[model samples]
Target: MTLLIENASLIMSVQDNGRFGFMRFGLPESGPMDWRAFNHANRLVDNPPDNACLEIGFTDASLRVEKDALLAVCGAGYQISLKGRKMPMWMSFWAKKGDLLDFEKTPGGNWAYLAASGGICSQVWMGSRSVYAIGGLGRLLQRGDRILIGKSIHRSRWDAGWFIPQENRPAYDIDISAGVVPGPQYEWFTDEAQTAFWQQKFNVTSRSDRMGYRLRGENLTHRTGADLLSQGMVMGEIQVPPDGQPIVMMPDHPTTGGYTSIGTVCRADLSLIAQAQPGISEISFIEINLNDARDKLTKTIEDIDKIEKPQEDVWTQL
Candidate 1:
């Protein structure tokens, strides 16, 4: 049998490829906020893309294993340990019955991913296990909640030698060298204000969440300040309401919004924006042309594919 989670400390949920095509009906794409990092974590465990994972939030969550299993923990800084011995993040490790796997909140990043050999087997909603926190539909793991495990991973190994170690961790800087193309509302801004947007720096406000990041910077302005009819929104679309401050949308952003969007953050750099932890410091936006943005997006995807978490594939030898 697969290992069970006897104690799920703080916030935890099963997230997979994310629910899509429903935004037409006003449902947000409520998948892993940092999907690139999450997918990489799964690959490290040899699990294919779309395998569900425990989306550990800002709070450090804890759990007790009920059986032996292989697991990989990835994404932002977090103190992970098994039965008091230190465990590495972004790499696979073993856990046995009664072994306590604990995760502490990261000082820099906003989320962490915990992936098992297969994945978390929770009741699916709309064909996904992603917890839409506002909908109250998917699994919202709580204390004393015994999570059901997937099938037992009979045979699997880890390539700890080849994979990169957690010590020399990759850096996630908020350099906005790649800004989004100004959208349908770009004409509304004066030339001077548009210049300031790409020139000035903005600090991530304390009110950030999975929904959107409220930025505090030079007052981003528009000529009309008039209310507009609600329109479609995607992650990274910077929506400016009446206050002139921009709210960068995230995975769970609303399907439609009435606010005017001056520009959007490119998909390639969305994670950088998502990983901006509260009180971390100032983040500046730099504008990049459309062609450059597309080229970068293609390269990022290929780079992630090359960095597979070798633990998952080891099972093939069994």
Candidate 2:
């Protein structure tokens, strides 16, 4: 079984959870931008949480089902159609052999995910199929790529009506107010800069990519001369350069950053920022306490855990 790429998006690739244990050697954990959506898509199709899926970024894609299979699409900014008929997002649907599937961008988000009943088969490096082109892990998917299906799910108790509840899904609003915890260098910025950071809005500049999102807004001045030695970095770190424009480190960010970090977007709200597009999204961040942020993250994980957790594998039982 396979899915043939007819027209791939600008950035489409097979990504599992991420590559771990190599970050110390300058590799970034390049997974799906919306981890929650990615997991839900897998869950709906009876795949394990870390199963590899197709990540579609900021555009449209077209594929043909080479075999009869169940599929699910989740995340924001796109709508799916099977054989030219509209399909629901966050729900599992069946695709017959030779059925054409199209993912068209609508609005209000950036990344989308597609998962089949069986997980995708890809060459894994360092225990992950996630693509990190800069580090040579894998490359961007092309139009002619053939994505082979993994193990078959024997038909037993499979349900096609599985869907992620609305409350659990991301809002994907045009304007987002994300919550961030103070970083180690929070005090590096002036008091005015700190206040403005919470009050002023920033437009995501076109100078954005999988690496980082450069924001255009008020010039945040530094109190300590903005001289911070290069430090280890992670996803969602808000680094302000000498120009005062802040750049939000993404999944493919460098191993370390030299600029001063104002704060870090919390896990619960990081996906909102990730789904935001450059021109259409305006973002503001408010301070979140470490304890409260931890609770929010715990809640997000619990919500994903409750979504379509498979009961039992029919093949395994037989």
Candidate 3:
């Protein structure tokens, strides 16, 4: 089966769980910005949780199904329509050949995920199908791009009408609190800088992207200075440059950096930052110990595992 891109305003690409274990080789894991939504979209269509899906960015796009297919969408700030009829997100739907799927940008979040029943057919690079444009693995989807669809292994299940509960959906409202653990160079910052980092609310600048989010807030001065030998970096590491502004490393961030880091946003809260709409989202940091971070992440995974079983009366009211 094939899916054709009819139109796109910005960039959309295929992203799976992520490219892992290859970061040591200088490859950053480029996956869905909102992982929970991505996984939920896949599960709604009865696809594996980590199956490849369309990662739609902060703009408009549309797709046309060349063959009958089951699909789902999940995330904030976007609306999906089939053949000009509006469809609810976080729920499974069926599309026949020639059906056009339209995605309209809304005002809450920045990214969304579209998953087909069998996942997108794409070449894997470094053990993942995620598109890392900077690394030249795959380019963004464009008009007339024909994306192959994998063969579905499961039978028809859309009649079950699965949906993500409203309470479980991620909120993209203002003044979001993101959990973090101290980075390796946490102590390098002055006490006042550290205090301000936690106390102040930082606005996500328009400069943010898959590489990192440059925040605008009170400058965080470092006692040990700004320049450091380039060291290994990871997703969520909050690195402060000489300008004293913090840059939260993301999935496509470089393998190494020369700035001092104050803390690393925990895995559980990375989605919160990822969904933060640039130029409008305000974020605050909450420090958590390593153990707590791990425990929270474990619980999140457990909750995701339970999504396959539909709960009565839990459908999100559109």
Candidate 4:
């Protein structure tokens, strides 16, 4: 089976979970910006959580399913329709051959995903199907690209509906609060800067991308003489440069960095941060202990874990 891209989106790529153990070699784990949505899309179609998926960003696009296949669209800011009729998102839906699915962007989030029942087939690179374009690994999706579909886990279980509950979806609120813990260079920032960061609202600049989110807000002042060698960078690390503006690392952040990191956003909120609309979202940071950060991440993992196992087996109905 195959899926054909009729109208290409602004930024579309084939992505799995991500590559691992390669950052030390100067390669970042390039994957879907919103991990939660990506995972949910796969689970809706009974694909393994890390199966390859279509990552669509910020564009009005459409595609035609070459064959009858089970599919799902999960993300924000996109109105999905089939043959001029509206379709519900975050739920498994069957597409007949020659059916055209259109995605229209609205004003809430930046990214979305389309997952086939078995998952989109792609060659493995560094143990991942994710495209790391900059590294010359793979390239962005193009119009007319016909991607092959793999074997799905549930071939005939469409009798029951599957969807992500309202509570489980990403809250694309205009203003969001993200919790983080202090980083190694936290003390390097002035006391006033620390207080202001927690108190003031930062606007996400349009300059941000998959590599990092550039926040424009309080000017975080550091010790004038402070300087350090470039050190290993991690996802969620907050780095500040000569200007007080902070850049929160994202899934595609470089392996190393020179800017001092003031804090690390907890893994639990990374998806929230990713869903934030650049130039529109007002993000506030709150500090928490490491233990609390870990607990929150665990809870999020548990929540996603429950999605893979459907509450009631649709197979039972058949």
TM-score for each model: 0.88, 0.94, 0.93, 0.93
**Candidate 3 clashing pairs?**
none
State how far residue 295 of model 1 sits from its true place (Å): 2.3
Error of 3 at 8 (Å): 1.8
Candidate 1 C-alpha lDDT tens digits along 1-318: 344455554456778888877889888878887777787677766677888888877776788878777777777757788888876676667667788888877576777888877677877888788888787766577777666667745353343312334432335664434367777687777787788888887878889887899988888777877368988989889898888888999888888999898888888778777777666656677777789889977876665555434555553332
Which portions of model 1 miss their true places by more than 4 Å?
1-11, 152-170, 174-178, 308-318
Per-residue lDDT of candidate 4, residues 197-311 (tens digit): 8999988888888889899997999976235798898888889888889999988899998888899998888888887887888898999899999998777766664543255
Evaluate model 2: give its lDDT: 0.86
lDDT of 3 at 241: 93
What alpha-carbon RMSD in Å does predicted model 2 have with respect to the real structure? 4.2
lDDT of 3: 0.85
**Alpha-carbon deviation at 216 in model 3, angstroms:** 0.9
Clashing pairs in 4: 118-152
Which residue pairs in model 2 clash with each other? none
Number of the top-ranking candidate, with lDDT as the measure = 2
**Candidate 1: deviation at residue 257, Å?**
0.7
How much is 235 displaced in model 4, in angstroms?
0.9
The positional error of residue 65 in candidate 2, measured at the CA in angstroms, is 0.7
